[model samples]
Target chain A: MSALITCSHVDFGYENHDAVVDLSMEVEEGDYFCVVGVNGSGKSTLVKGLLGLLKPTAGTITVAEELKRTGIGYLPQQTRSQRDFPATVCEVVLSGALSRRGSRPFYSSAEKRMATSAMEKLGIQSLQNHCYRELSGGQQQRVLIARALCAARKMLILDEPITGLDPWAIQDFYGLIRHLNREEGVAIFMVTHDVANVVSQADKILHLQQKALFYGTPSEYEKSPQGRKFLGGGDLWE
Target chain B: MGVIMEMLSYPFLVRAFVGGILISICAALLGVSLVLKRYSMIGDGLSHVSFGALSVAVAAGWAPLFVSMPVVVLAAFFLLRITENGKVKSDAAIAMISASALATGIVATSLTTGMTTDVSSYMFGSILAMSPRDVKLSAMLSAVVLGLFVFCYNKIFAVTFDESFARAAGVNVSFYNILIAVLTAVTIVLGMRMMGAMLISSLIIFPTLTSMRVFKSFRGVVLSSGIVAAVCFCIGMTASYRFSTPAGASVVLVNLAAFSGFWAAEKGIQRKNKGERRL
Candidate 1:
């Protein structure tokens, strides 16, 4: 598969210190690349760099031209404040398309159609007018996923999306994301702690703790010494 | 009825209504974004800054509008900056600026000596204080706020909901955040003549919060906030005129009443939903 994302020796950080140092990885087309790491491992920061939210102090991140503008829909880590934000699902989902809507202050008909389609795709059409905060965790995640989808058709970057979900919801969410990756053929770059499900479905795995510990196909990762140590002897107990 | 008509015919009352409505609309415009971003306290802090500048202007025999406007706007921007980048947290920054400005205002007022009535009037906001020139200035600033807000509605919505996501989507989050702060500063300054430094922030807070009891969409909140603000101000102005009550306090009370009613009604609805689900 061809590479859609090419990060060459990237170093990213905040003002005082670097969180990610000399990390290089590639997200191949239709790749379910799961980034597994411990807390404070710079996984979210790396996602920020790739999304162009944080500028790399050194090295390069090249996204394909077609997927550059509104091409990589991002579902950022849902925080406590955002969970209670006073906005409807429609408004929240519609905002994902703002980057591509250009100078128009009002949402265009086509953009509205895109939002509707995204909501339908996630089976959240009925919840369009509902307050986002009032929804269940699973439902809220679906709305967020629809929002990300509205922005980009080619790829999704989900950052710790299942942080607040219950077991049943997590399973449902995993099924949906896997379905999106396999059936819709959308490349997914996920930063997750769910080692079992992500590793099992992932085409590639990049184990990180400030730097790359392992980078290979899931099967290859299963045999690696570092992966065995990290993944508890490569047993997918969950 | 004849007395009410006579009051309406007075030019100062007309000016009050004109300027009050304009300021109310503009405040509502900034209200949703401000309250949502958890920067509602910034409005109160900036209003205190305006009071300090106003007292300085009064003591120095300067134009209050000219003296207070730039200072308050600068304070607003500074507050935004320090809150975002500096070591001090936003609430603490607001508290420091608020206390310091209030202290400065009280000291300046004490030095002025003879203008206690004017200073007191500013503190409580006399409806008669809104001159024709004040009306014109507020009208012009209101247009600018309305124009910019309408032109950048989508971008502002994105920034309000998620700054990181907005930044990732290439929305210039910093610029928009600063823009919201600046507009809020302008609203606080303009509304202070009718709403007072002590009470003007209610205009910046009440409408959006009251609307949130019912509407979930950002657009819904904006529209409803404007309507609620305009209606409450009208009622407050009319009641204050008829009863000779303090206009600023009257308007704030009106807003408080609306919020109380909405809150109760929301509880009722939730209770009803629970009942239905139980059945």
Candidate 2:
């Protein structure tokens, strides 16, 4: 399948410190690709490079479409900033719609309807007016997901979307990601530390160890050496 | 009461009172967002920068308005860009520039001789020194800040809460952040004549902190902060006039009183609620 996002021999760093080195990967259209890695594994760096938030220190990166300005929804790691920020859910969701169409004087009715529909799709209609900070961790994730849904152009890029959530919340979050992928066909590129929890839902798995170690279906990842190590040396429990 | 009546009768006194009211309202409104986003130091830094600029203008015999406002606004722009680019931590940039600005103002003012006629008034604030020009400028700034806050309140809230979320959703977080910074610059510029550099940050921080203790929602915080600030300005101005004290100190003292009152009342209510539940 043709790729929606492609990174060719990319090198990225921050403040003269290299985070990722000579990495290459591809994200196809309609792919729910979960990027799994240990802490400081440059998972977030890869996502940032892909989103053009951080330009690669070396090599060429290209996407199928003009991705720079087009709607690429992002869920950052620190959700507290969004939580304590003084904005209602509807206003936040409408921002997603705005990102898709930047600098527009106003949002059209259709865009408003789409944002509302996205919120409803995420089953957060009642949260439309709630202050984001007041919500539980699970509810906040759903709201952020809804916001991403409003703005994402055929794909969403989330950085550890399941952190600080309980098991039920994580399950529900996974369910929501799956629902977005299966029912709506929105591609997902999420960097996750909870490899096992999200493994079942991830359509394609991209395992990173400072480089693209494995990029294929979950079953294929299981056969790879790193994946075997990840799964506790083929015994399945570590 | 008689002294207050007499002070209220004077037009300049009334003007200063009104000016303080307007300034307090705007500062408090901006403070809500600033404190939430941890940009309280921005207010402090800009106030110092403006103080320096005003001192320069005074020493150079130029209109303080033209010199101070632009300098602080430019500083605000640079501060926002630096912080947003993640080149320097926001607070660090603020401390560096603000300290330098304060030092520059002190040195410049000290270098200029023969203008010791109530310079301390400007240093500590002399609301009574506010001319018609100052009142008009304060009113204009208050109106602009209030108008922009209304029109872009939603967007500003979005950006302040989560710039990434706002950017992801399609909000131009950079522009909004700059807008907030500019507004803060304006607020500090106008506030310098009344609140002074050393005490102005409290005008931005205390009202918000007090309101946060009592309010549960965004709207509640904004409205309550505005009200509390207005009252503080009024009482502070009156107290300064009656007691022949520094207007800036009076205003801040008034704010502290209001804050303490709110805190005590909130605690009292919570204790009563607990006792009722126990019963």
Candidate 3:
């Protein structure tokens, strides 16, 4: 399979502050890549770079280029926003598919169908008419995931998707990710603080510390010195 | 009673009523988005800034509408840029603008001799003085805003809900944020004739507060708020005519009543639910 995204010697920052430097990595099609790092280690920065939200100060980046046509899906961390945004679950999900269409015309039924299907796949069809702000954390995450899916992307980038979820919800979320990876062939690049579970679920682990520390399979990561040191010298997940 | 009947039959009154409804519709829709974006205070701040623009426009002997539009629009753009950079919290920035604008407006009015003569009209509106031109201008402004809202609804929804998520999803959040601010400026600029400076914020806020208590969906909140605002505008217009009350104050009072009534009803429902669960 063709590589979906490639980041080469990328340096990124905000004004005078440097977040990430000399980072190079490639995400292959159908890869479930988990990026684990301590807080403020530029994990979110890497995700932003991958999504083209941040332009690198140096080096080159290449993405699938389908983003203009099929669009890229993104699920961000749970944000505590106003509870009355005046949108339904369906409307929110419909926004995901909006990237593929022009803003001048109304949404077609096909777009609505696509949004509905995406919500159904995430088991959030019952929330179609409900207010987005009223949903629980887990439900909101699912709705957001569904929204992302509506964009018809070959890849999904999630920033700390399971951070605020319950244990059960986290497990279910992982299961959904696995399903999306295996069935839809959508490449997954997730930034997570869940160090323990990353080893079992992620096909590859990219550890960041102002740079790319590790980029390899989970087994390779386990044998690496930095992974062993960071993973506490043993299998923390086990 | 005779004046009320005569006012109703007059073409200008019809224009005021229609213009009021149109303006309220746009305000109600934009209010939900503004509240959701957590920048409701921007409404108050920007309207105050428009007061400065109004004073300056009057002083320059230009049509206040034309002068205020460009000024307020520029101010809104400046505010959006400042807040979007994350250099300052939105509330703090709005407060800064509000204070400076209010002070400037007071000074500008003092400098302009005729400004003080009818200063009270600008504060609470002189709906009775509205001409057909004001009504047509308001209608056009309302239509443009509503059109923009519909055109950008999807991206706006994404940005309003989770801006970072929208950004990651390839939505230009800054552009959309600016769009929202500009829309808000337009609403404020048009609403000056109906709500005036002192009460404009109420027109943007009360409907959202009232409907948020009763509606669960975002769309529901927007639609319900629009309905509430339209109803209030109609009722207030009628009351103003019958009771010889101030139009702006009457509409604001009606909206406040609706907001408080909804607040009470929601509390009653919550209590009833708790009682049932305890039983």
Candidate 4:
């Protein structure tokens, strides 16, 4: 019912480069916010700003104080380097709950239970002891999603989660995400290149182009000129 | 064999074996993360930095460990900075610092009179030289390294795997990265007494790479590296005693042999897998 995150006139930049400028948006509780943008449109930077990783060069951003306590789970886009990391699925997944463990040196029994439950939820319990690199792309994504689930209670911020998945795998991923949003009530703020199918599912669409271009419901996005131009005038998801 | 057995009873020889084992285990544990992160050369750079500090300390007639330890740790921290946020790239920064420090150490050694023997002892290393005080220091610091490493294992794993994701999840990536560099500096300085400045980085490189040849998981590689490093150190120390060779060179030679053996084993396994696929 209340806003979970708020960004007002935020400008995020790295030295001599402003990736995001005057961006303003809010993610409400239970909101499935999909941010769609072209290359170098500051989508990742905006997410970083929201996640408190990047400080705003201007304006302000606020994350709920309570959510910061339990911690937000982040699923970054799988990079080539991450794919080569020599970690077991259990090890990788266990690290997802690291922020929640406080100054305690090791993972608590409850944290291990959370990791196991997350893996089971993502149907990756069998891969717990297997090496992460040995898994297929779809399977790896599933493991990573399970890992993210281990870190949070109500929300997830996924950066290009289905980047390398096959079409069928993408559909299954979408189905799984939809289930999380609808069934488990987990809020999702996903950065995606896939703008079509998500149009029908997203509660809000924030189209970013070096700035926030559109911030409204999906129905409004469909009617807006910028949305029509970006979405190619027809439903491409079907 | 009887003479060697009698020699082993000497307190210094016992200290050498105990201190060397602790040093090797510490080096292997830290080396796994450094190897995985592609920062293995930082160990070499930090070692050279320690060599420079030791040379200066010896030239001034000060305690070498006291002088070198902090300097090496600071250099490691500086390297972390250069790699993490500075303009210079990580590998280039390592090379530059190592070269400059080595040059300084050489010049400092030449400037000091009647110290070539002292310089060689540090440069080439001799396990027989570890006094009780040195052994105690090595053990104390090594225990710190091992304890912190195990305690922060999950945090370190997360930081190494996806630094950006870890930071986003509220993990202090820089803190852990700095922790690793500091631990490595300590290990290198202590190991310089066992493996020598000329060859110490091998302790940080060989074991992890050898383990990676046979293992696919991080824990697997860390555990295997610890075993490989200890085994090689033992064999090397024994060979050094038996053949009267330089300690550092012997340990390095043993590690090189282990690396080659692992390489051959990995290749053989790959070939067998290929054959099975063909069938």
Candidate 5:
């Protein structure tokens, strides 16, 4: 498979110091990639760099032409203001089509269909008219995933997707993500702290601590010293 | 009926109603996004900046709206920059700008205008302040604000809901944010002649809060906020006419009442739901 995103010796940082240094990674098409790191380990910075939100200080991070046209479906962490925001599920889901609509004042019929099918795929069709703030945490996450699906069908980049979820919800979320990645062949790039749980599902892993300590298949990651140290010792940090 | 006829017979009163209702609608439409973004105090801040600009205009013998419009717009952009920089908290930045502007306005007025009724009308607001020229200007600007809000409704909703996601989706978040600020600046400057700097922000805040107490959707809240604001302005204007009260204060009191009523009704509904669940 062709690489969807290729980064070569990428460095990202603020004025004072570099947050990510000399990072090299590739997200191949249909790849289920998990990036694991402790807090302040530059996972977020790398995610921002990959998504083109932040410019790399050095080196090139090239996105595939097709992926650039479709855009990467991005699911950012929820903020405090979003919890009580008064928006219908349908409205929230439809907003995912904003980039695609591009200069259009309203969502086109096709965009509407995209949102509708996304909701149906996520089994949130019944909740489309409900208030977003009134939904449970799992339902809210499902709505967001549906939104991400509307943005792009090729790849999804999620940041800390399962935070604040119950154990059951976390498993359910993983199941949904797995179905999308494996069954639908949608590439998954998730930045998460649940390394122990995700290590079992992820095809490839990138262990980071300001730099890529290890990058390979999950099995190789398990064998690598950095992964063993992180999974065994750093698991407690979370 | 007689009071209504008497109030309508005066051309100035007619102008006030036309200008006031349009400005109310503009404020309410922009208010929904502002309230959701936690930038409700932005209206208050911009109005203070407008007050400062007005004082400077009065001191310099320039037309108030002409002077305040550009100054307030610049202040709005400056405020957005300070908040986005992450060095100071949003509320603290607003508070700092608001207090400094108000002080500058007060000093400027005292040093030159000496708190003249003309300046005080801009501070406390008067129905008589809506001159024919002001009404015409307010109407034209209100139309622009309403048009832009409708045209950019979806983008505004996306930006307010999630800035990061919007940016990721290739929406220009900063551009939309600046659009919101500029629209708000224009609405505040237009409404300030009738609502006053002190109470103009109430026009931007109360209707949204009241609508949110009952409405569960962004569109519903936005529509309801406009209706609520317009209706309240009419009621307040009539009451001000009959009671010889300040127009701005009267309008604010009406909004406060509406907010209280909605809050109580929401509580009642919640209680009823809980009781039904118990059964």
Candidate 6:
């Protein structure tokens, strides 16, 4: 498969210090990639860099032309305001088509269909008219995933997607993501600290601590020192 | 009926109603995004900046709107920069700028205009203050604000809901944010002539909060807030005419009443739902 994104010695930082240094990685189409790191370990910085929200200070990070045009589907962590925001599921889901709408003032019929199909795929079509704030944790994640799908058909980048979810909800979320990645051929790039649970599902793993400590298949990651230390020790690095 | 006809008989009152209702609708439309984005205080800050600009215009013998419009718009942009840079907390920045502007306006007014009724009218707002020229200008600018809000409704909703996701989706998040700020600045400047600097922010905050108490969707809240604002403005103006009260204060009181009523009704519905679940 072709590489959807390639980062060559990328450095992301503020003025004084670099948050992510000399990071080299590649995300292939249909790859289920997991980036595991402790707090402030530059996982979010890397996500921002890949999403083009922040420019890399050092080397080049190239995105495939098609991926660049469609844009990476992004599921950012929920903010305090979003928890109480007054938006219907349909409204939130349809907003994902904003990039495709371009200069158009309203969504085209095709865009609306994309949103509807996204909701149906996530089994949220029934909840389309419901208030977003009233949904449970799993339902909310499903709505967000549907939104991400509307933005890009190729790849999704979720930052700490399972945070604040119950154990059952977490498993359901993983199942949904796995179905999207494996069954639908949609590439998954997930950043999380829940390495113990997510590592089993992820095809490839990148362990980061301001740099790449490990990058390989999950089996290779399990064998590596960094992954063993992180996964073996319960909440030690977290 | 007689009171309504008598109020409509006066030309100044008619202009006030036309300008006030249009401004109210514009404020409510923009207020949804602002209140959701936690930038509700922007209206208040920009109005203070407008007050300063008006005082400076008075000192320089320039038309108030002509001078205040550009100054308030610049202040809005400056406020956006300060908030985005994260060098200072947004609330602190707004408070500092607004307080300084208010002080500067007070000093400038004392030094030149000497507490004139024109200045007081801008501070407290008077129904008689809506001149034909002011009403015409307010109507034209309100149209622009409403048009832009409708044209960019989806983008505004996306940006307000999630800035990072919107940016990731190639939605030009910063551009839309700046657009929100500029539109809010214009709304504050236009409403200040009728709602006063001290109370104009209420026009941007109250209706949305009231609508949110009952409405569960963004579109619902936005539409409801517009209706709430227009109704409150009409009731407030009627009260002001009968009671000889300040127009700005009267409208604010009416909004406060609506907010309380909505809050109570929401609580009642929640209680009823819980009781039904218990059964």
Query: Which is the better candidate, 1 or 6, if ranked by TM-score?
Result: 1
Model 1 residue runs over 4 Å out of place are A222-225, A232-238, B1-3, B86-88, B275-279
Candidate 4 per-residue C-alpha lDDT over B60-125 given as tens digits, one digit per residue, 9 for 90 to 100: 889888899899989988988877675347788789889899888878888876556778887889
- Model 3 - which docking category? medium
Q: How does candidate 4 score on lDDT?
A: 0.86
lDDT of 6 by residue, B150-202 (tens): 88888889988999888887788898888888888887887787888889999
Residues A169-219 of candidate 1 have per-residue lDDT tens digits of 999999999989998888999999888777788988998888898888888
Arranged by DockQ with the best first, the candidates are 5, 6, 1, 4, 3, 2
Query: What digit string (tens of lDDT, one per residue) describes model 1 on residues B1-279?
Result: 776687789988989998999899889889888888777888999999998998888788898889899999899889887767764477887888998998898788887775477778777888887888878888898888778778988898888888877887788888888888988898888788678889999999999999999777888888899999999998898889888899999998999999999899989999999999999
> What is the C-alpha lDDT profile of model 4 across A10-32, one tens digit per residue?
89899998999898888888889
Q: Comparing 4 and 6 by DockQ, which wins?
A: 6
**Per-residue lDDT tens digits of candidate 2, residues A1-238?**
6678888899998996888888887888789889998988899788767766778999888887645545677877764445566556786677677554544456688889988998999889988887776688898888877777777758899988887899889888888888888888788899988877666778889888787788788988878887888866576544
On residues B4-71, what C-alpha lDDT tens digit does candidate 5 reach at each position? Answer: 89999999899999999988988988888888888887888999999889888888889888889999
Stronger candidate by DockQ (1 vs 5): 5
Candidate 3's residue-wise lDDT over B79-122, tens digit each? 77766567458778788888898778777778876446456777
Instruction: Between candidates 5 and 6, name the one with more favorable TM-score.
Output: 5
lDDT of 2 by residue, B1-279 (tens): 898889978998888887778878888988888788777877888888888888878887899888888899999888776665664476787788888987787777778853474356556776765678777977988888887677666576667667766755556677777877888888778777777778877888989989876665676788898999998888888788878888899889988988899899879978998999999
2 or 4, which is superior by lDDT?
Answer: 4
For residue A220, what is the lDDT in candidate 6? Answer: 84
**Which parts of model 2 are misplaced by more than 4 Å?**
A1-25, A38-42, A52-70, A104-116, A127-129, A234-238, B1-8, B56-63, B81-100, B107-119, B214-220, B261-279
Instruction: Show pairs that collide, candidate 3.
Output: A86-B218, A86-B219, A87-B218, A87-B219
The Cα RMSD of model 1 versus the native structure comes to 2.7
In model 4, which runs have C-alpha deviations exceeding 4 angstroms?
Answer: A11-19, A38-40, A54-69, A163-172, A196-201, A222-225, A228-238, B1-4, B86-88, B113-121, B264-279
Among all windows of 10 consecutive residues in model 2 chain A, the one with the lowest summed lDDT is A98-107
Question: What's the true lDDT of residue A83 in model 5?
Answer: 88
Model 5: CA > 4 A from native: A233-238, B275-279
- Residues A1-238 of candidate 5 have per-residue lDDT tens digits of 9999999999999999999999899999889999999999999998888888899999999899999898889899988789889999999999999988888898899999999999999999999999999998999999999999999999999999999889999999999999999888899999999989888999889988998989899988877777877779435444
- The complex in candidate 1 yields a DockQ of 0.72
Top candidate (lDDT): 5
**lDDT value for candidate 1?**
0.87
Docking class of 4: medium
